[model samples]
Target: MFETELTRTLNIRHPIFQAPMAGGPTTPDLVAAVSNAGGIGNLGAGYLTPEQLRGAIQKIRELTDQPFGVNLFVPEQPEVSEQTEEAVAQMTEYLNKYRDKLGIVQNPSIKKFSESFEEQVQVLLEEKIPVFSFTFGIPSLDVIHAMQQQGTVVIGTATTVEEANHLEAAGVNAIVAQGCEAGGHRGTFLKSVSESLIGTMALVPQIVDHVSVPVIASGGIMDGRGLVASLALGAAAVQMGTAFLACPESGAHETYKQKILASNEDSTEITLAYSGKAARGIRTAFMNDMQQYPGEIPAYPIQNALTRDIRQAAAKANDSQYMSLWAGQGVRLANDQSAAAIVKQTIDQAYTLVQNRFR
Candidate 1:
């Protein structure tokens, strides 16, 4: 029953792909466990350095022989502008208070925003990852071609149908239709975010209808019913984040796991204060207080880099209020299970539901 195009093409038993919850959540154990359970597992390699990304991929390779994937955040080239200057000044000032609170004796300049994406791509091609997916923006055709030549399946994220068209034209093997309700960074690059805020149900079918490449549904999908519904909406598979956040194998903080387990649908929100991008996460004091500084916020990677210190320290101190609690809208439906169990249950229930409907 799981022998759909996605499963066959990716050589996985089920079409359920674990969302590569970038940062602390996607541990080696979590990725391996999901793949071991006959679904696609992913490493959130967006923030890792080339060495770190290679090391993490090696760790996943060591843990499982099953097919797994890696996701990278296509680095946004920092541009100089008035908005950038004002936002940086405001952000630096706002971050200073937290630095003082965290007791770092001296103000360390935030790390430079430029990242070696080419270095990371070299690693992916060298490692020969079965599936390599990128978010934030699309990779060049040459980069995509090189990976494809090595039999690597390249996937790109798309928040709008235009982005989907661009990705398909760029030769991505698949597109992740990231709905507005998805947790973590919104993969909107072309249009104003307001124009890209389409829901999963609405977004998936439109992309499926418009593009020839297979479409993977993401955002707000938590359980079997969501899976079946997504497939009904023409998705080849469902990529889930919040539901996997609570899994035992995840590397998310204990507090993060607790919050996800205890959350309700309305408990999460979209805020630009955390990463300078409009990401959906658990509402915190930091998010609320910083909401007024939208104009002062720098573009992504920069904003993402600025908040790294506070989020790390907050996690260490068990201070949930200041942490980047990225989550989807279906967080309330999360369960305390192992990643393997979650995969088995989601696929099993969804398969049964499809079978019953046909029968």
Candidate 2:
């Protein structure tokens, strides 16, 4: 009922993709389950070291022979100089409050803020992943070309039409049009995050109009209804994260899953408190308290690294207040079913919808 060029090209049965929810949710089991169910499963490899990334790919391959994707964070090299030390110090002191609450050390030593993108890309190239996608910004032409040469279908994230255009020019096979309602980090590279906060309904078709590649609609899309709507909006497929977040196969913290089930549409807000970069998640004490901080938050991996210990401590203590519970506005639609069940239900419901309405 929902076959499209994407499904044909990717050799999948359904036009659905399990969004790559980095930071543990996209477990090998989860990715394999979705791929086995005939949708492309994506491994969020952004946080993994090269060894870990290679291991994960091998694990997913063992579980499913179907095509799957691996996603990476396009490295952001924020200036690290004397000029930024003051802001870093101010933010560190402010975050220390959470450390105290979590009963961790007052201050922690962080040797490195992020993994090596070059090394990670080398891993992907070595693996010859079926699909390679990235966010934050475009990778170098050499990297993209190398992946394509290896027969990997490449995809890029875009928040605006301009970003979509840029991705197409860079030779991505498809572009994920990420709207404001999306969870996790904002994939805004070409413009200010504020300037790029377009809704999915408004953003998808615009990007589809501007780009020659397939447009994959993301953000707030939760069910069969969203899938049908995206197809109507000229999207070749739908990439859903929140819908699969609480599934049994997902590796999201139990407390985070509880919040997803309990929270409603108004529960989430965009906050830089957790990750430095803007990302949508269910609000908590940390998010609210950080809003009053006078100092500018350190950019990206800096803030993400500084808060890592606190988040880990909070998780160990079974506290959701400090963990980064990334979920889109479709929080109300999330469930704790199995990954295969979610895929089947979505396809079944979409089929019924198409029969009843589109016919």
Candidate 3:
């Protein structure tokens, strides 16, 4: 039988979840489209303000009545030292070039990190949102209990078996086994990003074996074969990021979508240049610049803030080289279709594979 709790809790027809991709790609239209297609779609609210988060949720509600999830980036207070300032200064040169192009004299100063987890949690609680997912780190015990008390289904992301175990201990209802081939940020928990880089084939089953909660396999899972492999490895469901990235409903810029369609398995790489945290994406000029200036990058939210203007300008100009272009190793599998069509096609193909195997 299909996994009962996951299906019942999420109210989804298929065991597929459209991963909550942060930065700019996961939009309300995308979330609504997937949910309408009988899969759980997610809003990546990590970078939005509390009001913006609420607005997006309301927008999704306007489109579909299906249950959906919101993903948050749990923030950690970093100790900013002189080294951090120097790193921020190092980005000035890059910022200056963008400023000149935009016809501004100086780069905009770093704005205070606007996302307040506490405030956003209150909003979710007030709205009685059905599902909540988190990456970057796990929420505190009190926060977890609070969300659970509101009857929200909680899912935590993990890049390794250790991270999976930790999420189980933290009382998450499910674990997203985010293999190295996944796009976006590497949710490595307390470990260094480099140390936890396990590929999908090797990581999913180990996490499934280690965690008491149900595992939702993510990363490099773009099609029927990938989905079947995840289920065989003990996953209750599968989450795909890059695969849905090319959908018309996704907020990914045209250039970003084109890059994914053009890429092969070897086109992406893990780099900390984008957000000061290691994430896999296509190699570009910005990535090259970061490589040339290793160890000079500021901490996240800081580096993320420093580059916001440049990234925005790049998106406006459709400049792939300067944009983040966040994606996974399964970029080649990204099909340019509507979100619902992609979901139906993937689920149908996977179901056929599963049935044929038994026959």
Best by TM-score: 2
- Mind giving the per-residue lDDT tens digits that candidate 3 earns over 145-220? 9889988999999988888888899999999989899988888877888899998889988987787788898999
Sequence-dependent TM-score of model 1: 0.96
Q: Output candidate 2 Cα RMSD.
A: 0.9
Least well predicted 10-residue stretch by lDDT in candidate 1:
105-114
lDDT of 1: 0.88
> Which is superior by TM-score, 2 or 3?
2
Instruction: Please write out the lDDT profile of model 1 over residues 1-359, one tens digit for every residue.
Output: 75778888988988899999888799889999999999899998887789988999999999999999999888765644665876777777767887787765334576566457899999999999999998989878899999999999999999999999999999999999999999998999899888999999999999999999889999999988889999889999999999999888999999989999988999988888877788999999999888766456777777877788888888888989989899989999999899999988998888888888857
lDDT of each: 0.88, 0.93, 0.85
What is the number of backbone collisions in each predicted candidate, taken in the order shown?
0, 0, 0
Per-prediction TM-score: 0.96, 0.99, 0.95
* Model 1 regions more than 4 Å off: 79-86
Cα displacement (angstroms), candidate 1, residue 245, comes to 0.7
- Residue 118 alpha-carbon offset, candidate 1, angstroms: 1.0
**Mind giving the per-residue lDDT tens digits that candidate 2 earns over 287-346?**
999899898888888889889999999999999998889989999999899999999999
